[model samples]
Target: MYNLRRFILKHHFVILFILLEVISILLLARSQNFHRNRLVSGTNVVVGNIHEMGSDVGGYFHLRQANKQLAEENALLRKQISVVTDTATNTYTLLDHDTIYEYIPARVVNNSTGMANNYIVINKGKVDGIKRDMGVISSEGIVGVVTDVSLHYASVMSLLHSKSFVGVRFKNSQQLASLRWNTGNYRFGMVEDIPTHVELHKGDTVLTSSYSFIFPEDMMVGTVEDPSVSSTDALNKAEIRFATNFATLRHVYVIHNLHKPELDSLKANFLDK
Candidate 1:
């Protein structure tokens, strides 16, 4: 208390000067509207600058999450490019006017790959016209499909899931098969039921087959990391390294085929017979 009083006495003159300056400014502002407006404007500018700096600091702290989101979006775009390339290269069946598969772009708002039943949440929903069963893809490759939705958000069954299955085929042969992840590797999976007769090679691209409505023909899935056959097995299985980087997934495009419902209804009716 003694030190505090001593310090205040020491700076008393300077404190009085600052108080008088503030009082004078307040009187001038009260007497002149222009002066008051100018003071307020200057204060606003300083406050805005301070707010911007604080926001930038916060954003810097969130870079990891932001980067992950960007990675997912990039993966979706890669999937689109692969689809176009496959369709153009004569390796995939080109969709005519009657084809059903389509694409809808979306951003990943929530995602988790560490769970037993992993799922991805996108920022698109019924309001965005996203429906269940539509294929979800990224620039890297196929992410999954829209499973559930609300007004502005939808859930996706990521391709990394053990239960997830989609029609897939070798790029060159176009032979159709089911593709699934067995939790063995995040970036690689085994392409099953590849016929032993079809010439197999390493580094060959694999894509979605035309038979599946969930994905358009030629949508990229992965590349053949290893092509090998068991000595006693009659079929070949290729170790496929997925093009889509699930670890860094962000944005996804939901595929909404205009003809999907009709095609699915017809198939369902036929099966009822």
Candidate 2:
């Protein structure tokens, strides 16, 4: 206590000077209109910057929620376009105007592309109306099909799988073919069952065929890669670059066919018919 008193007595002048300087600044700011305005403006700027920083941090944390909302909106828009169109007239003929496919937005929880039979796992399952045989796709293109389902998760057979078979048609010619991955490449696939005389053009896009009940018609699947630049062609078969990038697969949508039950039941008895 005695040392503290001695120290204060020794440095009281400095402390006093600091206090007086603060008081002088405050007085000058309060009395002078210019100084006061400057001070208020400075304070407002500081406050605004702090608020902006806080808002940026908050937005960063809510990105997932925002993405989910966007996915939902995209799904709704897709449903609105589920119509039968006349290619000759460029017009849609609404016979019943009934939506056939219902889209459920989901996120990829797990994915594999470096294997012969790759698969993808999504963050939704039976609880989210996901079921086996349901088609999966992304905004870019067709992804895969659901194979297994749990309460909160589901597994998908991606196009990279050796057994993957998807009915696809050339966007321009509407020539039907079956898409498969046999070259063990995730970026490219093979379209089989196409006639040997049929020539595939470079950059020609292939979309889901109406023949498949699993996927809606006209869903993008892949594009025919330039054969001259590709060395992975099988038996001179043209290589197709997949629309969906499996390595960076993330958000996806599960396709639920509204008339799947009736369509599938009838399809099941096709041999009998």
Candidate 3:
């Protein structure tokens, strides 16, 4: 108690001066309309800044949730669009007929585009009706083919894989070609078996062919980047800029064809012969 009293006595003047200054400022602010308004305005400014900062911090934390929600919405829209497009193109098919293809939305858990045989793993598998050889696609375009499936996960052979080949055709000229990764580039793939007679252009769209049972017909694969005649007189080769950026892939849809079993069975019997 004695030490406390001595400390207070030593700084008494400074403490009194601070108290008096605070009281004077309060009195002045209350007595003068301009000062009162300025004080309120300054307080409001500080509070508003604090509120904005808090909101920004909260929003930053919610970004991943927002993105996942957006991806789910997009997956639904894509399924609807694919169904509508297919219906419009079908001539003999009934309007009320069951859809030939179904899309199962999934998140990519792991991905690699740099390897010679790049593969992707998604957070859906046998339990989600994902099967081996099912086609995978992103919102932009074709992604890959499912090769293995567990109850809760699936592995995909990405288009960037050296062994990957997709049947594709030019949208403008309808010239059929095969797309294959050469392990030389990530953004581009090689379109092979393009007929020499077909007029080649730099920007022609390459799309999935109807012959592919794995992918829906007319799905985008890529756009031609460069075209050149191959050493063989029969064929030409072109570089294609991939429609889907595998490096940025986050969500994908697995395509299940209802008629795939029948087709596979027929192929198997034919192959046995």
TM-score for all models, in order of appearance? 0.63, 0.64, 0.67
Estimate the lDDT of model 1: 0.73
Model 1 C-alpha lDDT per residue in residues 1-273, reported as the tens digit of each score: 999999889999999999999998887557342122323321233443453455456556667976776777679779988978977786565568755556677766556666545667666677789987788888668888766666666767778777678889887887876787774567777787767888878898899998888888788899988787353567677778888887766556899888877898999999999
Tens digits of lDDT, candidate 2, 151-237: 666778888877788888988877887888987888899877666556678999989999998889999898998544333434345
Residue 33 shift from truth in candidate 3, angstroms: 84
TM-score of 3: 0.67
Q: Which stretches of candidate 1 lie over 4 Å from their true place?
A: 1-102, 229-233
**lDDT by residue (tens digit), candidate 3, 1-273:** 999899889999998999999998987556343122323322233443453455456556657965885787679889998887888785645453477998899877667788776777677767789888999998788999987666666777889877788999999998888999993678999999977778888888999999999999999898889876355647888898999888767767899999999999999999999
Question: Model 2 misses residue 175 by how many Å?
Answer: 1.1
Clashing pairs in 3: none
Off by over 4 Å in 2: 1-97, 227-236
